[model samples]
Target: MNYSKKIFCQPLLWVIALFLISSGCQPKTEEQATAENRETDTESKLEPLTTENVVEVLTSYEKEHADSLVLISTRHGDIKLRLYSETPLHRANFVRLTKAGFYDQGEFYRVVKGFAVQGGDSDTRTMKNGAYKIPQEFNPKYIHKRGALAMARYGDERNPEKESSSHNFYIVQGEPKTVQELRAFEAKHNMKYTPQQIKLYTTIGGEPSLDQEYTVFGEVIEGMDVVDKISEEQVDGQNWPHTIVPHKIKTINQ
Candidate 1:
């Protein structure tokens, strides 16, 4: 979080390369712990997502301040994330769902080494009953750098606006790139990267190709070693972990 204030800036089939993609435990602030407690208290009054009410529910959540942090405890390790206030819809939706215990038994079903890791499918019928979609929450301020937390969505053909899936999400764990690689990307994609972007991607690493295609509302604050470990774990043909990798995402209340 001490990095410069410079803002750097996918998809709705999320190929994830099917071949390409890719935590730590940390303490929480007193204020954050209190906020999380308040959120849990109000969870009972919140309703599940549904086709008829997805838009309305998202709108309601979008208007609220985004000041919460959450923990993604996986078999590999715990990843602490700071939700970005700029993408209010995505941030609010994530916070609300985390507080509801909707992600208790979720697994990191999709993992692409050196690319990203995805989860949030509560396979139970109860979660399916609450299945819904939310509109895209794209913003120029958020980028898909390594450790970025973004929502998963279907393809552009089926979802032109690139609306996000209500529950599924991913965290980028991309590899570093050289200026030459970045230039080639620019030539292919017809986009330019700011100097700050070039510096980050060439230094810390990230999936720059995914920028703007998906909504990135947060980033990991600690335990990135866990992310690296998970990315290197064994996976099946579909990129799912060969061994079960349990995940439990909840609001970090200290």
Candidate 2:
């Protein structure tokens, strides 16, 4: 009777051990499954926003929503800008950069009183790094008028072909210049502004001479006061602000 009991107990123990091993090797717990599903969902959502996928997204965006207006929020004030559909490259580039947090923690490095407040250098993007350069997309039709957002570039002698620097951009703040002033600028650059362009300038108040010279991709939409504050800050010889009023730019919700 003792041997018979031992035999039965031995088979039962083996059966229990096999069951434990099988359960251990089965699918993960509900908590673990949920966590894995969440991770996958996050990755899938971020895939479209990644740098690799940005270009395609921007290209499609340009065709359907060229007249989209963007609002830039700053600590000091909000600035609104209308994106130009004509300059698809510049518009797309600006959108891509903004979404990537490229303007976070950036300083208004150059501020000319009653003229413009400039920022967006790679240096402004981060304390430790400088920004990358972008190709020039100058449309003579897009002029530098009050509140106009324009790219800053090195002089043609240095930049040759008037290519724009991707990192630096400025928002015009001064009163619009007259046609005579625009003509003088055109003469200096050996270019001409068209009649249609002149009409646009007369109505819109842009510096036509600056068209095709600098890339005008956007304009100030909301926070001119914040720009004024930065423009009015005291600065050193190197254009570094003595007081260093920090600024950040965020995209407006559509």
Candidate 3:
């Protein structure tokens, strides 16, 4: 064999061997390829909810995630809530966002003493406004009592249809409404108060004026004290708390 040819062939063999070894190191196993395919499929399937598809998407989402119970944990205390199935769209939207890590990124930013504690739209969060809105799922039975969970929305001047905010929400820490006050609200809003509503407004107390104005989707079942504490936080001119109350919202079942 010619020494020149032998030398050249030796280096070429080594280079080919090295290339094969490097390529073989990253062997894509069957399980690994399957997992990657599944991940890609899931990502492709999840589309954004828009005004045209919000109702349809949420209606489908509701069937799978019938989760109603959610827990909001803050440094002050944990607020346990029971989402109402009556408001399916609102409940499903909330559950979806909670799973998508939406509320985990925000805080109880707006605290209005004796009125409500607004959250799920903190300045710290990136989702300043929702991409889509849920239709007003106003159930007359759901009054804005203390600890009642309701969706926040823009004013009627701009939003005549009264669509609910997809992310922002408030828990009522309302003061007691006198019978005279309830009557005044009914007359002004053309609303009628039931015996149970009047009793709750007078006794346990709530923002009676908010009845039917916003969609009440849930209620604080176990942590009214925490709700009260959050509401009483010292706030600024914009109702944002001086010391922000960061929160992590989670579904109890999920």
Highest lDDT among the candidates is held by which one? 3
lDDT per residue for candidate 3 within 1-254, as digits (tens), equals 11111100111111232222222112223344334435444433234455678899899999999999999999989999999999999999999888887788777765667777777754344432224668999888899888899888755654578787667788888878899999998897787889988999999998877777788999999998998888778865445578878999999973
Where model 3 places Cα greater than 4 Å from the true spot, the runs are 1-47, 126-130
TM-score of each: 0.77, 0.63, 0.78
Deviation (Å) of 239 in candidate 1:
0.7
* lDDT over C-alpha atoms for residue 44 of model 3: 33
Query: Each prediction's Cα RMSD?
Result: 11.1, 23.9, 21.4
Q: Which 10 consecutive residues of model 3 have the lowest summed lDDT?
A: 1-10
lDDT of 1 by residue, 172-245 (tens): 99889999988887786567888998888998899877777788889999978888888887876556677767
Whole-model lDDT values for every prediction: 0.68, 0.55, 0.72
User: What number of clashing residue pairs does each candidate have, in the order they appear?
Assistant: 16, 12, 0
Report lDDT (Cα) of residue 239, candidate 1: 63
Task: Kindly report which residue stretches of model 2 are placed more than 4 angstroms away from their true locations once superposed.
Answer: 1-67, 122-132, 176-179, 190-209
Tell me how candidate 1 scores on lDDT. Answer: 0.68
